[model samples]
Target: MALRHECIQRASTIGSNLKDGGPRRRWAAMLVLTSALAAPGLAFAQDDGALDIVVTAQKRSERLQEVPIAITALSADALDNAGATNFSGVVNMTPTLNSVPYVTNSDTLVLTMRGQGEADADKITKDGSVGIYVDGFHRSRAQGALFDLADVERVEVLRGPQGTLYGRNTTGGAVNIISKKPSGELGGKAQLTYGNRDYVRLLTSLDLPAWNNLSAKFSFLYSEKDGYVKNIGPSNDYGELGNLAGRVALRWDAGTGFVADYQFDKGRTRSTPPYYVNPSLVGVVPGYSDDPYQTYRPVDLPVSKTDYDNHGLTLSWDASDLVTLKSLTGYRELKAHSFTDLTVALGLPTFPYNIDQERRLKNREFTQEFQLVGHSGDGRLEYTIGLFYLDERGSNALFQNLTLPFGMGTVVTDRRVRATSESKAAFAQLTWTPPVLDDRLELTFGGRYTDDKKTAARSIVVNGFAVETDIRNRQTFNRFNPAFTANMKWTQDLTTYAKFSTGYRAGGSSEGGGDFTLTYGPEKITSYEVGLKSQWLDSHLLFNLAAYHNKIKGLQIDIPVDAFDPSIVDTQNIGSGTIQGLEVELIARPARDVSLTASYALVDTKVDTLLVPVGSAFDPAVNPGSPFAVGQNIADRFVIPFASRNTLTLSGDATFLRVGDNSFSAHADFRYQSGFYGAAGAGPAVPGREFYHAPSRETVNGRITWARALEGGSEMRVSLWGQNIFDTRNKQFIIAQGDTINGFVSQAAPYSEPATYGVELGFKF
Candidate 1:
């Protein structure tokens, strides 16, 4: 099928069809989508002997097929087998998840799920639409979402609104990371990897023997590599990485069915920013060409740094045979600094746009949660209730200077902003499997009430004068979200469900000039979802399909007043929109030693209305250069940017041979994404205006591994891996005609890591 045409037709026809046909049309569309995905060669499959995946998606241990929600769970072994080192790599294999790094920093991640999310991930004042939780504790800031993934047990990605269970900024979805717990067994493992560009890595972990009902584990990782793009200036190469992280966990099983766990983790990263290149300046710098991977700079290299620490404690008690109580507490701190050279060319002493900028963010957060889980004696009724609280303080400081000729007066802008937020929530959920229909029908109902408060202050200084100082404001928001789900089993291996849920993001104040009135209201979303999970052919194949439609209100958008000025952007609450999508996941083991996984997502987004203040920055009467006008309805012209319409992934693994105590396996994965707008929102597409459009791209990664038994009861393994094997020049961000007046600048993703091959050695006991 022509994905581009399909995407365009789907997006263009949604509003009218949805409005006319309503729910009936929506359901009919879902049926068509299901039929389209379940073509001739793709049969449904499920939990066979070797493919049983267990997940805690509903805050309880259950088989993946039995869960009614749309979720994808990947075990640690799967990640290791796929050569996935970070979340960005994992995203390529998942459906309906996109990770876009902010332009200012590579460490910050802007997460999107099902075409509903924010693009300005670097801002400390803005919250992410997708929520991230580590060991049941929320990570409020996107700055810390890209840390190391060592000592992880499994990761679960839940699509749609997770309002009732995970209520903080989860309008899009939630990502839950479960870390490896302490085991009462004496074991250890070590791994060493070496690759091109002087890349080197060492990972080690140890588990102590149990004693006095206590168990412990420790893990460490150190990785360093030279940049992939050479620099023509004094700075180091671009795309370099230097990271160190460690973790320690202890578990104590007290008497009377009580268990306590404590964990502490710390990590740090130091690297250079992504290289920017201007194709027009082909022969300007030494060794520079028209290639996007090469760059020319005359100034010293810029630095990007990140440091973080996390501590968590959890206590669980088996109050009785049918009930359990659990408490989770956590504290986290993060500090990050990033430097970028906005000028893509060697700043000639005569040029006027030689912008040198630096930004720093500091954050401290604390969270607490208590949960009670219980079930009836007959096991027909299950319930869970929880209370959550979070407190956070964050500060952002930005400095920009125009480095012009010595005689010319220098222009400088300095801004500092601080924000403090507190949130409290109480949630409960109940599930019942009635005696009717042979216990094959189930229903779930849940609700959550959240109260959020925020206080913010900003100070802006220009040149030697303070333009604004000590502007303070406070705002509060309260909301109640509800969720309902009904599941029916048509057969022993097939189950279908329908779910409805609501989610919201708290309101916030602007971080610019000292204006207390610059505030935006909260954004809300109501979602309707239908899904099918099935397994067939004796559990040899598994297929899962999900379709959803989301109605959003009061969507918040950040508008850039000037392309070159970051401090002048305005945030406002726009009107309403609709996002609909279809996702398909399939896994099959056609043979005993071969397995394959495939996934696809088709997302269609539309802006139903755009309401703006008459004299706002988006109003044409006040700003003729803007995309919107004062009185003219611009909803039809507004399209949700930064969301890809079509996404596909396919991966396969095969163990073709085994010689005595030696075995060899091969694995590979491929991903494709359709074109999408690069700018935050729909912008002026005129010839002279600056607009960005990310082009379509495809990437492939592969690895081959050989394992052998060692003298002791251990194993030794060696593997060779390559990412972006074809060296595809896929641009992640682009600014058109950046060197020309009203032009854009660009950066190939630092995480892309073009065309690299590496080998790793591992030993386990």
Candidate 2:
């Protein structure tokens, strides 16, 4: 009570001083607040007396509360309680994050943060603005981004530009997945789950005890399920899954303050994509249905398969109490193939009107990083310096065939492309804290220098005839990114910070049907942010707030080519834009056995001078007498698509019963998102293009669990979980074909899952 009272009094004094004078006086008042927070007697209030979260977002372990960056960390237990088993589940729990599906294939997933993302995610030559790292290794290709989490320790989502410390291509922040390390104890766990639609999942893990300072861990998982959508075609179901994955890790304490760890992982996934349906156009055509989730076709079922392997090694040496050295090396490979029915179950009369497509992608990458960390004897100054290098290679092949209105007409295309890239960088960061001003303030400075280069070759054939040959291109880019931060403690449990940072994304040549060698420039972003993190009532309550503004230059926009060919498109450095947003998170434990949390985000985006491609092949709105001409500016016609204006999430958990050795708990979550565009052009402004408008929606998920303690410190748990409890109508994708010279029709695909219920049993020893 006394600490609370002192905090209240200090806040009152600070508020008065802030209002007493002009800009300079206000600054002085803030400094005074910092001093009050740093007072010796009040420092103890910062301790929550509960669970503490540690993260390595800055290349060093530190308390999450003390870190100046905006981050959300979730433990393994929290994830299990939320019923999250994959990457898609993470977005459902985080308000500022969104996942967009790739229309061409099911294996690829596009991620967006704070209204910043790339639209051409399906292209093999393009890379995501947001970076994904697992066990200190980067995942470069989006095609293989979503993998099952077997033994994940924690997941941290960092908001804003993290380019300076994390290196290049992090303009929209990063996601870090840290795996549980091999412990020096003997233990293991196993679980089985059964759900609706005949869904079955199994997972097992074993940890071997230490022997001569060496320990090992192994994990495996298998899952299979039936599709939610009922197909009236030759196949009985659409959107099915059968996957298998495993991992092995070994850790050795070499003695003398030195250690080494190595890990290997492999996975195979086979699945069927969601059946496509256009409810709006269903009744307009003779053979289409109005039900969004129901489809009819006579063709065979399409299937997609992906196989991947990952290898990583890390070595560390704690030379002294004040300095450490670390090295990380990794290699990853992926091969994926997908077949899709572009007709989307359309039962058109003409054979050529229906289309079928297939895609094959192979990728491999190698990365290495070295770091040196040091701190002053007084524990006031800290610094880190590192070097990074990456080499990658990939290939993409696409095949399409169409039968024309007449039996005499046939069209086909086969395209093969191969690419190679390399990147090198050097980075350094330092934070200083002086004894003056009560040691309440810290200033940080960081920067990175990167050099990137890429080369690609392409071959194309039309109707078994060579149309384009011997096409090749090469490009190189370099950038210097910097970051600055000012952090201050305003009270025993309150801290505030201001930061400015910059990030960059490499450029590449166009590998499209229209023009294979056309090139685009790199993309960059400069971001400014201010945030506050606080805990009150003896650490029982927590609140965090962050607001940011970002300036984007050389935005890359993919534009379709001749209407005669819809499969080909070109990427262009269209224009500049701005993204601004606010995020708030709150957690409270009003009672000993109950906890509640909520998050909200507001995002706004604008592109001042966007350019659109114009031509008979490009525009469905254009006819012979159309007034529009090629190269005309269409800045006002485009909107930042796939971005919701407002997103909110509310969750709660409560312990209902407790016996001598048994306990029961209930958990629930509700999420809501405002309506936004599902694709680039929203309306009829861009002819021959598809315009999809996504309606606002809400969903609810709930879970109940019971745990019992066994002998020898072992335990057992059982849980019942259900998502979309209300059977909500939420569509995942939409495609509307406008008036086109090729007599193109409309198509759309809705989300397949609906009101799924499941049960799980697990044991740990």
Candidate 3:
């Protein structure tokens, strides 16, 4: 009680100083607040007296609060509360992340963190700036980018450069997905849902604990929804989706504190293609709707199916009190097939054809890490070291039919390509606390080095004539990413910290080549950050704020072929950029039944040297007899696409008592994003065209749940939810081009879904 009063007093003083301050007074206010927040360590401790969030940010188990870094941790409960069915839904709750999907393929997810992400997903060879890791294993294929979270434990989004501890493929940040381990308890659940548009879904899980030291859990889900577009040819227009998933785990806790576990997960999904409309004609057609874009001709002909499977084993041995060893081995495989009709080619009657594409990706990764953590000189210094390896292979095939400009038309073309990549690395990190000043201050540092190799093959066949090419490339670069962090506790309710870190991403080759073989290089970044975590007002409210500045150099950017056709465009190690931002998160529970959570992020990202392709008329002189005849410089035509500069999110949760041992709860959330461009245009002479000019938009969602107690500690829940309640019609994608005349023309139009409402029933045993 005394400590709480002291914290409130300090907070009051700091607030007063802010109201009457010049530059000096502002600094003093910050110091006072930091001191007050850092002093209440005991009161802020978790129930078990351990760190609230267990993180591997430093390659070891450290409390999220103790790690002097900017990050967001979402527990499994949070995911269930938000109704996150896929990766895109996950980003809705995480305001710092953004995902852009293509109209032709909505499953091809492009993720960006803090405005630093790949601008295009069409390229097959370019690696994403933000890396994704599952059970400590990195995923390298873009085609298999989305992963289902059937039984996930937690998700960690570590912002800024994580190259030192994570090693390679993480320029902007890293996403760590930790799946739920096998439980010793025997319990499971079943759920069923129904919504508008003929939407139906079912989910079930079962747990078996008959075997000693071994437990197995299985989960399956199936869902179907009507298409959004009107199929003029099929007479029926409704998109559909179906999914199935399963998982099993085995764990053994041997004497001497040794633990070993193995887990496997398999998932598959078949979905209808996204709806497309001509953006130039949107709003012009009265009674024309975004829902109709979801419709496609020959419905059975245009469909996409994906299969994913992964298995992993982890071994941890607490050899002694001072040293420990951990090893994780995993293998993953993914395959996808997609078919789409050429609606954009409707005007070309000579050859109205469709496209068929297939992709197969496989990866096998093995990582072994050994760390020696012990208290030296009365628990003053701590350290850890580790080694890692990864191997990935990808294969793709494309089939297209070209119609002659006249009735004579019809030519078939097929292209196949394959690529393989391997990487190895070593890393180490350490922290030193002098035990001086009553253990109020701490310091830390870390670094890592990596070597990588890649090879690719391509085959093209036309009129039974075959063309083949093979290329091999290798690169070995040593990077020493280090970090320094300091934390001081001046009071019982607050803590202040500052951190500086370095990160890196490895380079590879362009899988396909037309004219030139593009070579990509590594990208590096350095970030500096400071923040304060505090709780006051008798622990009724909590607020955390952070400010960061990142200087990115040698960033890798993909140059599209339209800018320079016939030329194999690859990633280039060019230009530098800056990202500065402030993040604030508040959680308050004024009453036992009411909770408020609000988060805001202000980000500013800019490119120093903007070098982009501009697609314009072909130039006959440059390439005689080639289709491209007009000449135009398409460089600096448009700002990089899919980057929203501003974003905001707010949510609230309320619970109330109902009739007969029953309870009801309500949840509401809102999300907003600024406008951004969709394509790249040629320079001055050929003003780059704009597609899907996504203006600022906002969405609101809400849900209500009612629960009743059953026999033997069991419970049943019924819930109702609605998404996009406003029924806002928005464009998700737009592809455009021009003909001989300089008039606007659209190649394809894709619109997002409208409002959706549904009811869910769940029972827990």
Candidate 4:
């Protein structure tokens, strides 16, 4: 009762402060405090003593609380309640992680975590800072990470360097997704949802015990939503997606314990072109709109369709009580064809031409892992040793069509590219629980070694002139990423730890043409971390905090070249950078029916060095015989794109269980990000313009669910959910080039989704 009174008093104080301060300041203060207060409640609800979170951070199943790593685990139920149907939704609720979907193309998804991420997704060679894995299989490319979830068991996001255990791609961190296994019980569930924009979704799952020691689970999901933009061409607004998926698992307890599972997913979509609203034209031009409001052009070309498919399998054997072996194999194919209108040619005597294009990306990967885990020295020491191997291949292509006067007809330009990469690694780790000190202190140490190789090929055809080139590159890199950590229990409910670890990202080549080497060296980082995890108030409140500093070297950067004027420009290897950040997460269940969750992250990243390309003084043919030739240099140092320096998230849920076997739950969530730059340009004249900017924005989302339990072991649930509830207007991309001489370059305007509301119906047996 006293605690409830204190909460009421605090709420009143907050309301009083809001009345006395400016709206902006008051909002900021409220967000910070609310996030701080809700963190403990959220953690407690997710990590309660009723169930233990099992994670494979070190290739071994262990309790999340005992992993000695900074991580967050979300169960399938938690994700469903949060309405995280895709990768973007997952990152939206996660701290220190952000995702950007190409405005013109929803098929392209880019993810950034811990201040380290890719600047451009258009390029084929560059890889994301963080790596994503599914069922122990590595998804080396971004396309696969954008897939929808059907029957996920749990997801674990490990922060900091995971190089010692995950290897090669763990420079920033890793995301591990565990899918649901076949159950030995016959059961099924189905869900249907309807929303604005003619949105509809259906998801169903079935589990069957086909035979003794063998079971299978089939899960499928389908979704479609009309585009927000109206396409005058065919009256089809575009934005729509459909998917089909299935999985099968077999298990046998032949004294050796073996399990094999396979999964397949196919999805396709036709999305609207990013709506680039010219702020200058808003309210000035007739029918011009911005943000929650939308406007369209009579002749705008609709985005073409894109299709993607992926299939994978996992095989594992317990071998014995002391050893385990696993193998993951997968194949993926993506095809995208679209038409982009480069110009309106408005107010002129000409019509717009289409930049008709097509792209194909394919990847085939196989990974084999062997792990030996057991106890030694009177069960005081536990250790794990692993070996890993991976192989991947990918390709892309783009084509364009232009219109000319005097009946010159149409001209087509083509660009094609391909890449193949392979890697092998070995890792080992040991954890010791000291016999003395009442087993209060545990120590862990590990290291890994990796080797990588890559090859790239490109060809371009313009005006019937064909140019082809092949670049063969082989780089063998060996890294001994090591870590040392100590976990000590100070009291019955408190634990603290400090760790030092190393992370690495392998080097790769570029796709475009350049006389110089397009490959950059690997980037290595050493991280220093200190954290504390505490459970107090009789396990009702949980507090977790971590402070980390990452020193990175050999940063890779892309420099765009001017196609119109060959001598105009190109890109190069930059220098080094550093990132320092602090993260806090809290969850508390102060009352039996109420819970709150909150998290905050503050990150500061800066560039330390710059690499500039050196060119000849003058090229008479291209430079018009000028004595001084223009070259490239890195000027805007320390600018990191796609990363918000400050972020705060807060959410709360209140559940009420009453008579008539009914329950009601209400949830509200808020997210905020500071402004940051998008591209890397010096003066903006270079082709494939380098630098762009993004403004700060905030969004709120909420949902309410009501469920009733039936007498015969069945239940029904109905939910209403809303996104972008405030209808905040934000730009996801900016194009800074104009077609005409008049400085009127068209900005490829991508607006955030307007307020959306939906109703979901779910039935379980």
- My TM-score estimates for the predictions, one after another, are 0.89, 0.89, 0.83, 0.86
Residue 229 in model 4: lDDT: 53
- Colliding pairs, model 1: 45-535, 45-541, 45-542, 46-535, 46-541, 235-301, 735-744, 736-744, 737-743, 738-744
**How would you encode candidate 3's per-residue C-alpha lDDT over 195-306 as one tens digit per residue?**
9988877777777674755566676767666766657665345344556777777777676678888877777766655555443333443333334554433444455777
Give the top-scoring candidate (lDDT). 1
Q: After superposition, how far is residue 470 of candidate 3 from its true place, in Å?
A: 3.4
The deviation in Å at residue 227 for candidate 1 is 1.5
lDDT of 4: 0.63
For every candidate structure, what is the RMSD over all alpha carbons to the true structure, in angstroms? 6.9, 8.3, 7.8, 5.1
- Could you give candidate 4's per-residue lDDT for residues 1-765 as a string of tens digits? 554345434533533432123455346445434432332112232434332346777777776556678887776776777777777667767778877766436656667778877655555555667888877667666643456777788778888877667634576778888887777678778999898987787888888865866677777777777766555455445344444445554544443477766776666655544545444444444454443243355545555566666677667777666556666566656666555443221111232232333445555555666556665636678787777777777776766566554566776667677777777888888888888789889899888887777676767777788855443555566667888999887776688899999888777666553543446668788999999888767766566788898988777655434312111123344566788898877665676666656677778877665544343212234334333224433333325556677776666666755667899887666667766555444223333333245676677777789999987788999999987776766767554432211122334446666677899999987
Q: Against the unseen true structure, what C-alpha lDDT does each candidate score?
A: 0.74, 0.73, 0.60, 0.63
Output the lDDT of residue 51, model 3.
28
Question: Which of candidates 3 and 4 is the stronger one according to TM-score?
Answer: 4
In candidate 3, position 388 carries an lDDT of: 71
